[model samples]
Target: MEQAQMPGCYRHPGVETGVRCTRCERPICHACMVDAAVGFQCPECVRDGSGTGHSRTANQPRTIAGGRITAGHPHLVTQVLIGLNLLIFLLGRLNPALIDETVLIGFAFDPDLGRVVGVADGEWYRLVTSMFLHQEVWHIAGNMLLLWLLGGTLEEELGRVRYLTLYLLSGLAGSAFTYLIAAENQGSLGASGAIYGLLGATVVLVRRLNRDMRPIMALVVINLVITFAWDGIAWEAHIGGLIAGVILAYAMVNGPRERRALLQGAACALVLGLTLATVVLRTAALT
Candidate 1:
């Protein structure tokens, strides 16, 4: 059998690479890559910047994090994510059995199904599904409210792609941390981790834009206080998501010129790797 042909850099046809110009969609090796307005661009594409909707040139609109500016609906991703979570919550309400199958649990037996079910049982998707599922009205209400308030700002500043990345990764980090710390039979669910991630990112952004810090600072303190003081709160998930968000946001906001994409990508990979590692370790311990 022959191996599949690798994509060669457009500029240097002999050089193989998987990276592509975000604008023209041509393969580009690291040396031929240029971080354009939103992401990497090939030299040819960058030369045509004024003609296209992308580029570092002033003709194009961009966010603080260099994502394409969608002026008409800056909060589009935020709205969709909020709506999806609400939809899932409603579905769970309509079919209560769905909640048991999807809730984040380290490891547990389902007597109704007469089988083991959980992350440790290889149902890893629960980490993602649980974040969008809430049983009680108050639980969903609180999470959706915070997401609406905080996510719009993030989606506006970071653009849709980056904002969504931060949200989902934050939630997964929270689930992984909770899995490691909570009892094997214990089930925890919420969007708290993702919410706290956005909250932490807001602080970094406020500082970046030189906005007044008092209002947001007060809010962070209050949430942290609640995370600790409130009963049934999965404080571990909150802390994990907060830490991941701060690191990821710093990369998205402060990533240096000439290598923003590379650094930001690295940061995202690091957070994801850490989350996966935590899950693997915890699962091993449980089994």
Candidate 2:
């Protein structure tokens, strides 16, 4: 009787092998084999079986972690933003005299002053810095609470760079709108506008995922009511930030999966460019 020829490994045809992939039952050499829960599997089987037990959807945003955001991981960007706001607020409290002449003058969004003093006069920084300033205890507390709630989710989904970009651009949007609508010499300060942007982003993100929007809508509506009902609130800023957030989020959600980073960056640049143009035109009109 002649001896039978043994089957060779699928990946290495030249080598004969008795070992087989547990998942695909194909002959596999040690080099092509991957460890599985129950037994060994081929590379192709291992690749196909990844995340087979999880419940993630196709529409869900991908992150650096290769998994959904969990409570175990800390939202570092959100925490840093909150800390910066608190630190500024504390500094303002420590030196009460700095509120007007120093802090607000140097950082708060003052369209009238910006128009007159101009960027050469150091008012340009206010567009970015104003988002970190808070005067009253309630103001800082409320903004921080909202930032914690919304920022964590947005940061987790969008990642740090995108989250920070959305925030700063949102602030600039708010300031631009305030400059266009606010009375001359009126100074505004707070992270409320950026926080509102986060809310709008949340709405767009939820809608993209085909999830319920009522809860998020309710939050927005309530905030809008408060914005209009309260005295001295910059409803213009809130509205501007919300609109920017919606547009930015839409761009992000609709972007191609393979070119997401490029698309997102382009969207942010468009928004920033439009905002800058508006400011320039408004300032020219004032001049």
Local distance difference test, each candidate: 0.83, 0.70
Please give the lDDT score at residue 50 for candidate 2: 48
Model 1 clash pairs?
Answer: none
lDDT of 2 by residue, 1-287 (tens): 99997787775465577888775689975445555555666655554544333212212323421123333454888888888889888988897544454322212344533443433244566666677888898988988898898888777656677788888888788877777677545677788778888989989877765567799999999999999999988888899899888888777765555576677778898889988887776666655
In model 1, where do residues sit more than 4 Å from their true spots? 1-59
Tens digit of per-residue lDDT, candidate 1, span 173-238: 999999999999888888999998999899988887656789999999998998999998889889
- Model 1 misses residue 41 by how many Å? 20
Write down the TM-score of every candidate: 0.79, 0.71
Question: In candidate 1, residue 32 scores what lDDT?
Answer: 56
